[model samples]
Target: MNKTLIVATLALTLGTTAADAKTRLLVNCFWPSSHFACSEVLPAWIDEVERVTEGRVTGIIPPKSVAPPPDQVAAVQKGIADVSVMFNGFFGESVTGPLVAMQPFVGSNSAEAMSRALWRTNREFFADEIDTVQLLSQFVISPAELYSQTDTPMNSIEDLAGRKMWVLPGPLAEIAKKLGSGVVSSPAVSSNEIISRGVVDGHLGLDPQAVQAFQLMPYTKSTTAFSTPIYSTSFSVFANSDKWAELSPEDQEAIMSVSGEALAAAFGARWDKAAAAAVAAYPEAGIEVVEADPAFEAALTEAAAFVTEGWLKAAADAGMDGQGVLDFYTSQLAQ
Candidate 1:
């Protein structure tokens, strides 16, 4: 009986050793297979990582794989998967500097400005939050717009009051609350269920491609262009801490070369392309597009200042000098 047990142990050890010898990377995505970024951004990244590493690394994004967006960061930290996106709202009550970029009227063109700011954050303030895993890159989603069930235009906050609107966490929900809407936060995966069942009168959480990806048009009759980017979700690529540690310095450098800010540049370019497709499809979806009056846009700017002050308070409590980071970030953006 002792001899037989020893043989079984040997066989199990050999099998485990063999599996560890092979290089593997498993990526989780927050969108379905149809999303341009999931299809294009992920595959190209896997190929580049493999090419740069000379086949020392390989990856796959299984179809319908990622569970939900907000849960993805925790999944990576627990080593459930190699890498995926994370929502900024989950960073507790404080840590709101990152949330400032999401405030309405922060910037109309976030692709460039926000992406650079993220690169800076990763190099500086975010190390502790992301210490569990190796951070590859941080980037934001496209600008969010209001999608309504009727042609009642959200031209002003007064227009948004006394109505129901769907909003996710972070500054978007805060904006919705200030506007007097009953806020509803839904996972991207479950957006269809809530929107279809009248869980919300309208949704303020989607970018353009979201209209088709979530099949939102069935519940949407109109869309209002935000005065500026209302909110942009943050995403980061992460590898399990143990897996990252096992790699050599050369391999680590290679990973950063192919991932992180390099990949972030690719992310911005891809969003530019996807945004065009989303804009083109709005007509076919029979959704009316409306632009807010200039006066209304100015009022939103004032509300944004109020929210900005709150973010400063939150950031200070987090032990980060809010004014310093914000000032540096905006300066780099200007230069």
Candidate 2:
């Protein structure tokens, strides 16, 4: 072959090698495309992962979620997708650690504090329960609150009698039932339809941004805010363990450097901003937001105690120091 032909062949091989060197990961986002989780956090994290790895690895989210919110964990674990974000409570008895964050009144107003605390708590106590997947990060979104379409604000326990309240799964629902509220349950994605169609009188456990996202403001007449949130939803970004193992150790290290608590903090901070913006726009949307009265608060405190006691009992049965873990998480928030 001529010298020019040899040079051209070498260039073609080099180009092919360069293309094969890039690792592209597909993220099966559970949140809607319009949600900040999909719209902001996921993309930002993807960019960070690629940048930190010096372009060795990159991630892409589909224009729409490949799996429903509750099914994401299963989808990723079964290798139907390489990555996913899952809500721990949605899996029922299958996973346990995220319950620490889901515990009523256990979270702070500061999403960053709650998220980082949950990350630390998971590291210390919940790893075994979550060992099925490679955890990229853990987060507690906004603290939970109630929004009602009612004649008057929900100011006391008496006001809850027989009123329909949409409750998320787990302790929050249990608490609502114990308080004499008629519980209607549905996922956050369907909240707008549920309320708009008068399927339920109100929802019990969504953050302000979620409420706004679902366009719940028009149907919701009153929002009862607690001194501390009623509950928080725990979310985790994870990858299929097999897929995660395929990455080079250096790439894994580079990706993780931008994950864990730092990733959680960034997600939490964005959630806070979204919640604040949603809450700020409430009046313009004609929704009445009110603080829970002291009497109502006392009742909530009693209900929280009941729920926490149940959780602690369950934790002890699992050979974990439930109160100790809770105390440590709360302490971390103070710092």
TM-score for each predicted model, relative to the true structure = 0.83, 0.91
Model 2, 76-166: lDDT tens digits are 8898888888887776765656687877777789898999998998888876677778988999898878777876778788777568888
Residue pairs clashing in model 1 are 136-260
Candidate 1: list runs displaced more than 4 Å.
1-22, 64-68, 93-97, 110-113, 124-129, 197-200, 332-335
User: Candidate 2, after superposition: displacement of residue 57 in Å?
Assistant: 0.5
lDDT, model 2, position 148: 75
Please state the error at residue 21 of candidate 2 in Å: 1.0
TM-score for predicted model 2 compared with the true structure: 0.91
Cα lDDT of all candidates, in order? 0.72, 0.84
RMSD, every candidate, angstroms: 5.9, 2.8
Poorest 10 consecutive residues by lDDT, candidate 2: 89-98
TM-score quality measure for candidate 1: 0.83
| Candidate 1 lDDT tens digits, 1-335 | 69999999999999888555647888887776777667998889889988887777788887875556667767877777877766667645634555645655664455655676767765666555556667787766677777787667677778777678777655667777876788887666677888889877888777877767677877788887755666666666677777778766777788788877778767866776676687788788788889877887787667657777877887788787877767666665565
Model 1 score (lDDT): 0.72
Best by TM-score: 2
